[model samples]
Target chain A: MSDSDGRRGATRRGFIKGALAAGAGAASAGAAGAEAGDPAITELQPWMRAFGPGVDASPYGLPSEHESHVRRRYVEWLRPDTISAVNFTPIHQLDGIITPNGLCFERHHSGVALIDPGRHRLMINGLVDTPLVFTMEDLKRFPRENRIYFLECAANSGMEWRGPQLNGCQFTHGMIHNLMYTGIPLRHVLDEAGLKPGAKWLLAESADAAAMTRSIPLEKALDDCLLAFAMNGEALRPEQGYPLRLVVPGWEGNMWIKWLRRIEVGDRPWHQREETSKYTDLLGDGRTRRFTFEMDAKSVITSPSPQAPITHGPGPTIITGIAWSGRGTIARVDVTLDGGVNWHTARLSGPSFDKSLHRFYFEFDWDGRPMLLQSRAIDSTGYVQPTKDALRAVRGVSSGYHNNGIQTWAIDSEGRAENVEIS
Target chain B: MSRFRDLAALSLGVILAASAAFAQQGGKLGLGRPASPDELAAWDIDVRPDGLGLPEGRGDVLTGEELYTGLCAACHGDFGEGTGRLPALAGGEGTLTDEFPVKTVGSFWPYLSTVWDYVHRTMPYGNSQSLSDDEVYALTAYILYLNDLVDEDFVLTRENLPAIRLPNEGGFIPDDRAGTELPAFSAEPCMENCKDRVEITARAGALDVTPEAEER
Candidate 1:
C-alpha cells in the first residue's frame, strides 16, 4: 500500500481503538459480563445484529429523534395568540450558513394560510400596459434564479433595546433565518406587464387574513426582488407561503410578504400602516424614522451562548457564530474575549454570499478563565456593528425596531454563559 | 367590375395574413391570461394615505363605539388600552419621550388614513375583511375618539378622513441612516483597549425571560 493510504488506515484504526477502549471501560464498570482488557470483537451492535427498517418506512423523512430538541421556540408572553405571533429559530443549536427548512423562524400577522397551489393566482395590475394574472404553473414558466439571503425581522433584537432582556441567543437572535430561495426575478414579471411611465412604487399584497401589504419602491422591485416559490430546494412549507412569497432582498422580513397575490404599480409610496405606524423607528426626540429598509451589519456568537453553554471544561474550544449584513456582504467579524478591551479578527468560512449569513470562527484555548464574549461585524459598506451604548446614543431605548447592537455573553468560571450588557 | 373584385380579394388576403402573424406572436409564451377588470378589482383592496382606495362610506363615533366594543374590545380593550399582550390603540398621548413610551394610534401614528386602512384591512384579528366599509369607518372614528383626537359627534367620511391631521403628523422623517449613521459607524473600528474599564450594566438572565437550560 502507498504511504498515504497506510497513514489513513492507521488513523482509522486509532479512532476505532479509542472507541473500543472507552466501550470496554463502560462495559467493565457495568454488569459483570465483560472483561476489562479483553474487548468483545465478535459482538455486534443492535443495528448490526438486526435488519433495519425499510426505505418505505418514511415516505417523508424527518430528522433523527435525537435532534428533536432543535426546534423553533416562542416566549408565550410575547403575544396574545399564536395566530398573530412570532417564533424564533433555535440559533444556538444550528450550525453552518443555511438554516434548516423546518427550523426557519416564523412571524405571521395572520396565521399561516394553506391555500391550494392550484387556486393561487398572482395579479399584476395598475399603471401597466396589460393587467395580467398568473397561476402557479404560469409562474413556473418564467426564467428563475436562485439566491441565498438572510431574512431578519427589524425587531429581531428589539426586546434587547432597553437591556439584555433575553438570555439565550435563540430568543434574542433567532428572529432571522438564512435560506436558499429559488424563484423568478420580480423585474421580469413587472416587465411582462410593461410598467407605465409614471409608475414609481409597487404595492405587494398578500392573500392571508390580514392581507398584509407593503409599498415597495419601483426601483427596488426591478433591482433584486424575487417572487419565491421554493426555499432550501423544496416546495415552501405551508407556513412559509407555499404557493408564493416575495423576497425583498436586504429589506425587513415584514416586507417579504408571504402568500403574495397582487402587485399594483403606482406613482408614489402608499405610506401604508406597516411603513408608517409599525415598522417606523421612534427616536429619543419622539420623531419616528420611516422607511428604514436596510438591516445593518450584525453578528452574534451562537456557540458558547446561553443555550449551548460550554460543557467540556477547558482547553481547545471553537468560538463560532454567524455574521450578516443587509447592505451587503460581511467584510469582517472581530470577536472580543474581554468585552471591548481586546479584539481578534475571526476567520470567515463557507460561501460568502452577498447579504447572506457568513459563518465565522475563532479557535482559542480557554485557560479555565471567565470571559466576556462579544462579536462585532463590519459589512462591505464599511458600516461596523455598533456597541449597545453607541446604538442607544443615536436611536435611544424607546425604539423597538432596528436594534442591531453588539451582543455580549458573560461566561462564568464554571463555563455557564448568560446574556449581559456592558457599560 | 372584375378589377374592383380583384382589389377586394387582395385586401382581405392581407388582413388575414396580418391577423395570423399577430396570433402566432400572442400565443408564443402561452403563459397567464390577461386579468379581467372584475377579477383585478376583487383582490385590489389597498388603501393609500391619500384616501385613494377608501370605499364610499360614513360612520359616526357612536356607531364606532358600539362596533368596537363588540368586534374589537376583547383584544384591544373597550378603551383601546390594549388587553394583555394585545396592542393599545389609545392613551399614551405625551409619553413618546418617556422611558417606556406607550405608542398608541392617538399619540404615535402619523397618518389618520393608516388607522382607517389597517382596521379595514386586518382588524377584528381572526375574522379579517368581515367588516363592511361603513363598519370600518365607524371603527376608525371610534379609535380616533378613543384617542381623544375627534369629538364624539364627528362623522368620518372619505372626503374629510384624509384631511384630519394626526397628532404626530410631523413626527416622521425619511430614513437618514446613510448620512447620519453610516458615515460615523464607517470609521475603522478600534482593535486595542477601546475602553479603560468595562462594567456590567444589565443582565437578561436576572429577568428570568429565558427558559431554564435543559439538562444535558
Candidate 2:
C-alpha cells in the first residue's frame, strides 16, 4: 500500500485497539464517563501535520470525503426508470433549516430539464386583457420578493401509510426541503397582463419534456405565489427548475411548477392530469379529495432516527428534529420519551419563518433504557399534529397523500433505533 | 367598402380597450411583450375537462391497440393492468373504497380531458409528447376500451371524447379539510398518559423494506 494509506490504516487499527482497551462500552460516549488520554486527542493527527489542497484546486466546493455517505437516495422498487421517479433528501444528516441546494430532494415527472436562460420565456395568456410573454431578462425587470418556504411532496411518508414500512427518517420524511426563493410576485406578473373580470383559476405549466400542468385558484395565485428564478441566494439549480419555477407557497410541491413556461388565467378550475389522475387524496369511501393543495403541519426526529442512531450512548442525549406547517409557523413541538407516557416541550431553534422548516431539540439524560421516541408539532394556527391511529380513523390508510401523522421510533438500550408503529 | 371600414374601427377599439383595462388594473410595469396569436397557440397545450383545448383528431380502438402495444405495453400491460412498478391505466373501476384501492385511470379519473392532455403533454414514458394528436386520441380510446368504457370499433374524436364520462366522475369531492380535518387535528393533544398502554404493533426493521438502510 502507499505510505499515506498505510499510515491511515495503522491509525484506524490503533483507534480500534484503544476502543478495546476502554472496555465494551461507547467510545468517548458521554460527558460523565469518557476514557482519559484518548489517542485521537492526545496524539499528533495526520491532518494537523499535513498541508491540504490549495484554494485553486477546487473552484466549487463539496462535502468532505468523510461525509460522502450523506447523500440523496432512492428506492429502486418505487419506479422502474430513474427519469420519472423520486429521490429523498438526507434529512438525518442536516442541521439547520435551509437544505443545501445539492441535498434537496428531487421528483421528476419526466426528468430534469437543463435550459439556456437566454432562450427561456414565460407566457401569460387566456382570460387576460392582453396576453403577454416575458423573456428571462424581462422577468428580472419586475420587482422581486424573497421568502423562505418548505416544499413538500404530497406523498412524503406514503410508504408508511399502511404501517411502519420505510426504516429511516430520510426515507419516510425526506421528500421535502425549505428554501428562500427570490423572484417576482406572481400577482404582480399576473397584474402586468391585467386579469379579465371572471379569471378565477390559473394554470401553471412547465417547460420540461413532460410539460406538467396544474390548475390553481386565482385567489391562491395572487396570495403568495412567485415566479422564482433563484433559491438559497444563488441561481436556481437545474433540478429545481434553474432558469425559472413557479412557487405556490404552502402548497404541494407539484403545484410549484418547476421549469415554468406558461401561466394561463381562466374562469374555472381545469381538471388537469395532475389534479385528477394524481395528487388527489383517495379515501376508503372511494370519494377522493381534489385540489388538496396546502400541506398541514408535520415533524420528524432526524437524529435518533433509524438512520441516525445515537453513536455516543447515554448521558446528555440531544434528540433533534425538524417541524413545518404550510399554513403558518410551528409554535411548539412536544417530544415524548416513553411513547405517550410523558412529554417535554422541545426548544425550537433557528429562524422560524412562515411556512418554512423549524428545527427543534429536546435535551435529556439518556438513562440507557429502551425508549419510544416521538415528536409532534403545533402550528400557529393551533393545529396539533395527530397520532397515526387518529389520522387513520378519519382519512383511512388508502390515501397516500397528506400522511402528516406523528412518527414513532423505538430506541434500544444500545442506542440503535428502528421504525415502529405503537399502540 | 363600409364593411372594411367597420372592421378597422373595431380592431382599433379592441386595442384601446386593452390599454385602458391595463391602466385601470394599475399594471404600470408594462414589462413583457404582447404575446402574438402564433406564440399563444404554440404554448396553449392544456385541454380543459369541457374539451376546450383539444386539437381536432380522430382515432379508433384498433389503431390505439397497435400504439399501446408498441409504445406503452412495456410499463402498462397490454390490457392496462400495469407492469411491475408503473401505474395501471385501466381496470380497478370499483376498488377505490376497498381495503386497498386499485386507483387506475379508468377507475378514479374524473375527467377524460386528463387522459388526452396527459398523453399529449407527457406520455409513452421515455418518449413523451412524441405522439400525434390522433395517436393520443387512439391511445385514450384504447384505454377506454380496455376498461369497457367503449366498444372495440369505437372511434374517439375530440368532440365525442369529453362526452364519454369516466365511471368515477361523480366520485370526487373538493377538499373539506378545513371543516373535517382541521377541527379534528387542531385540538389540545394529551401531553402525558395519553394512552392506556403502549405496545409495539409493527416494526419497520422487521419488515426490512427500507431501501439501502441498516439498523443504526
Candidate 3:
C-alpha cells in the first residue's frame, strides 16, 4: 500500500474486533491499529498524543466518535415520522449496566416538555382534609430520600412477541434506565396534606401539554412513590421530568408522571385513559388485563446479545447482563446453555438491591459450536421468570404491551448473534 | 489563567470586605431594612391543604363549563375523551382486571381534592390557569360531571370540596415492606466460599425468550 494510493481501504472487522479485544476506546483504535506490532511506529504516536488538553473536553461526554453510528435504528417500515415512533439503543454494543442517560431509548406520545422549574408547583387537594400547594423551593425543605431504581416501559419487549422482531438489546430492552434519585418520600407529602379518613387512592398528573394523569392505589403511593427532584445527582434533565417527577418505584414508567403538578386524594381510584386504552393488556378473548401494576422479575444478557456477537470465540468468555425485580431483590439468576434442561447459578457481579438493576456474569468456554444462550431470574419472593410458553399461556399474545417474555438470541457457526423465536 | 485567578481572588476579598463594611454602616446596607410585613404579604401565596392560601372568590359548575369549553376542551376533549394520544379523563372504573381498563375520574379516581389542586396549579393545557380561584373551582366541578362523578347540580366550593369522596378512595395502602413481604436479607455476613466461581451452561439464541405471537 502506498501513502498516496486510494487502493488500500481501512481494515474492517479485524480492526474493530482487535480494538475491542485490546480494551482501547473505539476512537483510539484507528491510530492504535496502525502502530500495533511496530515499536518505531508506536514511538511516533505516543499514547498521550491520542488525547487533547483537558479544557478541550466537555463537562458531559458522549460515546466515542467511532461509535457515531451506534444509535437507535428505526424501522422505516413502522412509521411516517422518525421521531413519532422509532429508534432503539445499541444494547449489544454497551458494556456493564447503567445505560448512559442520553443513550437511553425514548418513546414519547407527545414531544419532550421544556418546563421552567421556577413556575412549578405541586398541589395536593380533592378528598384530603387539608389542601396544600408546595412550590419547588417548599418541596426542597422536606426530608428527602435517595434510591436506585429501574423504570421499564410496559412495552419494553412488546415487539418481540411476533418473533425476533428486532435485533439488538437497544430495540428489545433500551426502554429501561436505572439511576439514583433524590426526593421526598411520597408518604410525607400525603401526610402533610392531612389525608382524610376515607381517602384511599390518589391521582398523579403532569403539567406537560399531554396533561398525562393516572390513578394510583393509596398503598402504592404511601409505600414507595417518591416525589423525585433529582436524577443521578444533578437536577433532573428536562426530558426525564425537569423539576419534579413522581417515582412510582417498581411500577410501569408511564405512571411516573414528569413535571408533576398535582395529587388528589380520594376514597377510590379514577380509571384514567392511561390505565385503560393504552397501558392495559388485551387478552385472546374479548377482554383486557387492567391495573397490572407489578413488574415481575426479569433479566437480559447485554453483551453477546444481537448487536454484540462473539468476536472472539471458544475461550474463557465472560457473559454479563442485568437482572432486576420490581417485587424485590433478585434472589438468583440461572444461566442455561441447553435450553432449560441444564442450569448453572451465575455470579451477581455488582450491587443487587430491591427495585434496582443487578449486574450478573457467567464465565464459560465455547467450543466453537453453535450455542443457545438464556438467563433466568428468581426474585426474593420465590417468583421465577416464566418461559415464553408459560407467560403466553397466561397473558395471551393479543396484547402489544407488557411483553416480559423470556428473550433468546441465536448464534450461528459464523459467530454472529441474531434475534430468534425459540418458542 | 494567572490573571483570571488573581481577579477571582480579588473579587472574593472585595466581597469579604463588603460584608464587614456593611456591618460598620449599621442596620441597613443602604438597600433598606429587613423586609416589612406588607412586602412579605406581596410574595406569599402558598395554599395549605387545610385551606390556608385560598384567594377570595368562588365559582360554580355553569361558569366552570363555560371556562373549560373556552380554554380546556381543545386538548382535553369537549367531553373529556381527551385529545389524540392525550389521556381520556373520563370513564374506566372497576375495570382493573380487564385487558383494556378504562380508568376515568368517575370510575377510578380516589379523591376530589386532586382535581382542585391540579387545576389550580396546572390546567387549560398550554395556557395553564388564566382563570381565577373561582374559575378553577367551577372547572373542577365541570370535569367531575363529565366523568359522571357529579350531576349538573353539583358544586365544588372550598367548603364542599373536601367532603366529596372518590370511588377508589380506600384502595391504597402504605408500602409496609418490612413485616409484609420479604424477610430482611440485610444481615451479619457470608462471603468466603459461598460459591467458588461461576460457570455458564447456556447462551442467548438456544432457548425461548418471547412468547408465540400467533398463539394468542
* Better candidate by DockQ, 1 or 3: 1
Model 1 C-alpha lDDT per residue in residues A1-423, reported as the tens digit of each score: 223323333432243344345545654555454544333444566877899889989999988765765788878888888998999999988889999999999998888998999999999999988899999999997768899999999999988998888878989999999999999888778877878999999999999998988889999998899999999999999888888999998899999999999999999888888888789999998888999998999999999887777756578888999999999999999999998899999999999999999999999999979999999999998899998889889988888999889999999875678899987
| lDDT on C-alpha atoms for all candidate structures | 0.86, 0.87, 0.66
Q: What is the TM-score of each candidate against the true structure?
A: 0.89, 0.91, 0.65
Candidate 1 vs candidate 3, lDDT winner: 1
Q: Candidate 3 residues A1-423, lDDT tens each?
A: 133433234333343344345443443555566757444455566655686648647767666655555565554554444433535555655655566666556555445678888888787777764566777887886657898888888878876654566666766877787888899888777766567888888878777655677878899987888999998888887778888999998888888888888787777665554664457655544355567777767888886765566766467777777888788988888776544455778998667767988888899887777766778788887766765656666556656676666677666655666666553
Docking verdict class for candidate 3: incorrect
In terms of lDDT, the poorest run of 10 residues in model 1 chain A is: A4-13
Clashing pairs in 1: none
Superposition TM-score, candidate 3 onto the true structure = 0.65
Could you give the fnat of all candidates in order? 0.75, 0.80, 0.01
Q: Which stretches of candidate 3 lie over 4 Å from their true place?
A: A1-43, A46-51, A61-63, A67-89, B1-216
Superior by TM-score: candidate 1 or candidate 2? 2
lDDT of 1 at A85: 92
